[model samples]
Target: MTRETPAGDLTLANLTKTFGRRTAVDDLSLTIPQSSFFALLGASGCGKTTTLRMIAGLETPTSGQVLLGDRDIARLRPYRRPVNTVFQSYALFPHLDVFENVAFGLRRRGIRSVGGQVRQMLSLVQLDGYERRRPAQLSGGEQQRVALARALINHPQVLLLDEPLGALDLTLRRQMQVELKRLQAEVGITFVHVTHDQEEAMTMADTVAVMNAGRIEQLGAPADIYEFPATAFVARFLGQSNLIAGDVTGGSGDDLLVTAQGARFSVPAGRSRTDRGPVFLGVRPEKLHLATAALRVPAGHQHLDGTITDASYLGVSTQYLLRTAGGVELSVFVANSGDQQRFAIGERAVAYWNPRHAFLLGRRAETPDPTAPVAGEPVGVSA
Candidate 1:
C-alpha cells in the first residue's frame, strides 16, 4: 500500500550504546520516513535489537538523540512514548482470551467503552471469531495476529516488531509475510521491524537498513540495497555472492580494470574512486552464466574458465560450484528453462558476466579496542 501524504519521521543522531567495556552500538544514525515499512536487517548480535529497543525507550542510549516526529524522545519512558512493540514471544496472557488480551493496554489506561474498539481491532486482524480463545488454544500464527492486534489497538504512531514471525513454520511464515504486508497497508502506520532473515526483509520492507557491528552499513530501497550493496559485508550477507579481491590497474571512461588471482577483468567504476586500492569485486550467483559456444565473449568482456565441482537442482534453477584455473571457487546459478543442459561434476565451462554486473567494495579498517588508548595518545601500534 502506498501513502499519498508523508507519515512520521524518526531520526537517530550519533546513537551509541555500551555495556561496561564493550560497545553495542557505535555512533549510528538513520532516518525512517513516515508510513514506511522499514526493516533493520543483520545477523544475530549485530545490535539490531539494541537499536530498536533504544528507539522504543526500552533501553536508553549512552549518548545520542532519538527524535520522533518533531519531539526529542530521548528521556521519554516506554509507556509515555506513542509507540508499541510486538515481541517475538507474543507475550500474551495465557489465562486471558484474545479479546481481553487485545484490550489489556486500553483497560490499563482506564479506557471505558472499549468493547467496540476491541471488536474492531479483532476484526482488523481477521481474528473476530477467535476472540473467545485463550493463547493456549491459538496456533503460532493466530497468536502472532493477536499480538499484532494488541499493539495496533493502541493506535501508536509507530509499531516496533522484533522478529514477530520468526517462530512460525515455513509455509505459515510465508503466508504471514503477505498478510502482514497487507495489514500494514490497511492501517497506514509506520512499522519498524527487526529481523535477521534477508528474504523476509526484502519481501516486506519498503526500506532496508543493513546493520553490522552496531552500525548501519547501508539504508535504501530493497532493490537498490540488493543490486547496489554499499559494503562487502552487505553484499556477502544479504545473499549468495562471489567476491573476488583485486587491485585497480586501469580506467576507461566509467569502467575499471582489476587484476586478481592471475586474471584481469573490467568492471564499472561504481561509487569508489580509482585511488582506493585493494578493492573487492562482487557479483551475484544469478548474474553469472555458463558461456555457450554460440555466445562468444565480446571484446573487453570478463570471463573465467572453470570446471564444475558441484551441482544442485532447485526446480527453477540449477546451482553450480565452479573452481577456476586459479583455484578460486565461484558459485553460478543458471535458470533451468526448457531442455536443461546437465553438466557432469568434472565438466569444463566458462563463467562470465558483464562489466556492469560487477561491483567494487571498499576495504574495511581494523577496529580499535575498547580499552586501548585514545588516538594521538601514546599507544603501541600492531606490527
Candidate 2:
C-alpha cells in the first residue's frame, strides 16, 4: 500500500547537548529535506548518535529547537512526536511472533484491525511467510527486516536508523544496504541514518554529513566529498588520500603551481580550497599511477620520483607504497588489467597523475593523529 506523506523539511536550529562539562553536541543547525535519504557519518563519540537522539525526542537539547515544518517538537514527549527509531539491537519483543511484533504500534493506538497493515509490511520487507516466527527463530537479516517493518507500519514523519545493520555479517549487511534504500524509496519519507561505516554511508545515503568533535566537518554528495574534501580531517576520513604538503609558488593559466619536497606540481585553481601560502595537495590513491623511472611521464601529468617501498597484490588491484628522497610517502592504486607493468618492492619508480585530479586543502585546526587507522585500508575481511 502506497501512502503519501505531507512534505515538510526537518530543521535543527542551533541545537546543543551537554553532559556535565562535556559537550556532546555543539551548537549545530541543519535542514534535511522531506523524502530524502540523509546520513550522519562519524567515528564513535563524534555526536552523530546524540544528534539523532535529539531529533527522535529521546534526548533533549540543552538549547535550540527541533522543528518539523513550522512546529517546534523540542519539548514534546517521545510518544507525542511523529518519529520512530530503529536501533542496532532491533528491540523486537522476544515472546511475540513476527506478526504481533509488527502490529504492536497499531494495537497500542486503539486500532483493532491490524491484519491488512501487518501483511502489507511483511511483504514489503520480503518476510511474507515468516509472520509466525519469533525473533529468536529468525536470522540476523530477518530480524532486521522485522524491525524495519515495525517502524514503517507507524507511517512516521521521519525514520531514524542508528547503525541498524551493524549486527549482520558482511554479506547480509551489504544486501540489507540495498534493501534499506529500496524501502525508503517506496515509502517516500525522510530517512536519517546514523552510522560509523564510511562505505555504508556512501552507498546508502543521498547526502552524507561527516561529523567531528560534535560538529559537521563536511556535508555533500558522497562523490563530491570524496573527490574534493573541504578539510584535512575530511580528506583522511572519507578515504585514502595521498596528501603532499606544499607551498603555492604561482599560477599558470587555470592551474596553481605548488612546490612540495622540491618537486613541482600543478593543481587546478577551481579544485583548490585555498590559494595562498602553504597548503596540502591531495589526490586519491586510485588516481595516481606508478611507472618505472626510465619511462617518460606524459606532458600534462605531475610527476614525482620515488622508490617502491611496499606492494600488495589483491585480486582486483595492486596497492603500492612509494617513498621519495625528501621522505614523503605516497600511496598508489592500480587496477589489475592484464598486460599492465608490474613493479617489485625496492624498485625506483615515478608516481604521476593529471593535475586536474589533485585538490588543495588548508591546514586543519588539529593535526591528524599519526596512529589512527586510515579509512579504506585493505584488511583480511569478507567481501
Candidate 3:
C-alpha cells in the first residue's frame, strides 16, 4: 500500500451526529496525531462508535468538519474518504480465502497485478502461510488480522476500528491488543480504536478519550487520565475509585485540607479540581494501605479509622472493604508478599495513603457509585 501524501493529523472539529430526536455524538472535536494509536473509550451508548462512524463517513455529521491535515472530507462518501473501517464482525467473505480477502481492496481498484501486494500484506499481518485458508477455517484472531490486512491494503490515512476485538475471548483479546499496537507503530498511520474495555484502551492506545452522554468527558494518556481524572465519571468509569465526599476546609502549604466522614485529609493543591466548596476526595484502591494495631500509620500520611467489613484473599492481593466511623465505606488493596499481614472481618483497622496519591473532584457526577459491589464483590477489585 502506498500514499501520494504523507499521513498527517486527523482532526474532527465540532463533529456531531443524531438519530431523530436523540443525539449520538454531540459536537465532538479532537485531533489524532499522525501514526498515533488513539482510542475512543466509553460504555455502550456513550457515542464512541457513532463518533468513529462519522469519521469513516459511515454516518453523516449533523454539523462539523472532518479534516485530514487541512483538507475537509466531512461530506465525502464513505468510499471517497481516505479512511477504512474494521468492524467487530471482521466482515470477511465466507467463500474467500485469506489471500483473496486481503487482496479484495486492491483488486476492486482494478489492480491486475496484485500477487506481490497480497503476499506482502499477508506477511505484514503474519498470515503469509495461511493464504489458502478460508475464513471458516481460520481462528477468530486470524480472521481479524485478515480484515486488518484488507483495510491496510488501501493505505488509508486513518483506520477506524469499531470494537474490532469484541469477538475474541479474553486471552485472544489481550493478544490482539498487543498486535494492534505493534501494527499501528509499524504502519505509521493514524489508528482510531473504539471500545468500552478500559484495559484494552489503556493497553493499546497512546491516548484515550473517555466519553459520556454523547460527549468526551476527558482525554489524555492512559496513565495521566488514570492518575488524574478530570471528572467523577472519568474517575469511576476508567477504573475502580474510592471516592470520599468532602468539603475543602482550607489550604496548608502546597496541600488543600479536606474534611470528609469525620476524617481530615490533605490533597495536593495541584491535584485538587477545586480548592473550595464541596468536593470528592478520590484515590485508587491500590494506593491505600491497610494497617492494624501492629502496624503504624506512616508520618505525614492521611489516615482513616475504619473496621474491616469484608476481606477476600485473591491470590496476588487481598481486597478489603472498610467502613469508617462516619459510615463512609472505602476499599483497600494490599499486595500479598508472602509474609504480609492479613486482617479479618470485624477487625479494627486504618487505611492510610500519601497525600500526593489523592486527587480532588468537584461534587460527584450522576454516574453509578463505583465502590458499590457488583455480584459479591467490587468490579476490578480482584486480581
lDDT tens digits by residue: candidate 3, 184-241: 8888888999999999999999999999989989989999999999987898888878
Residue lDDT tens for model 1, 298-326: 66567887788788888899888777777
Candidate 1 lDDT for residue 108: 95
Count of clashing residue pairs in every prediction: 0, 0, 0
Give me the displacement of residue 233 in model 3, in angstroms: 0.5
Q: How far off is residue 136 in model 3, in Å?
A: 1.2
Candidate that beats the other on TM-score, 1 or 2, i.e. the better one: 2
Model 2, residue 339: distance off in Å is: 2.9
Provide the TM-score for each candidate, comma-separated.
Answer: 0.90, 0.94, 0.94
Better of 1 and 3 by lDDT: 3
Of the two candidates 1 and 3, the one with more favorable TM-score, higher being better, is 3
Q: Rate the local accuracy (lDDT) of all candidates.
A: 0.83, 0.89, 0.87
Model 2 TM-score, 2 decimals: 0.94
Ten residues in a row with the worst lDDT in model 1?
364-373
TM-score attained by model 1 = 0.90
Residue pairs that clash (backbone atoms under 3 angstroms), model 2: none
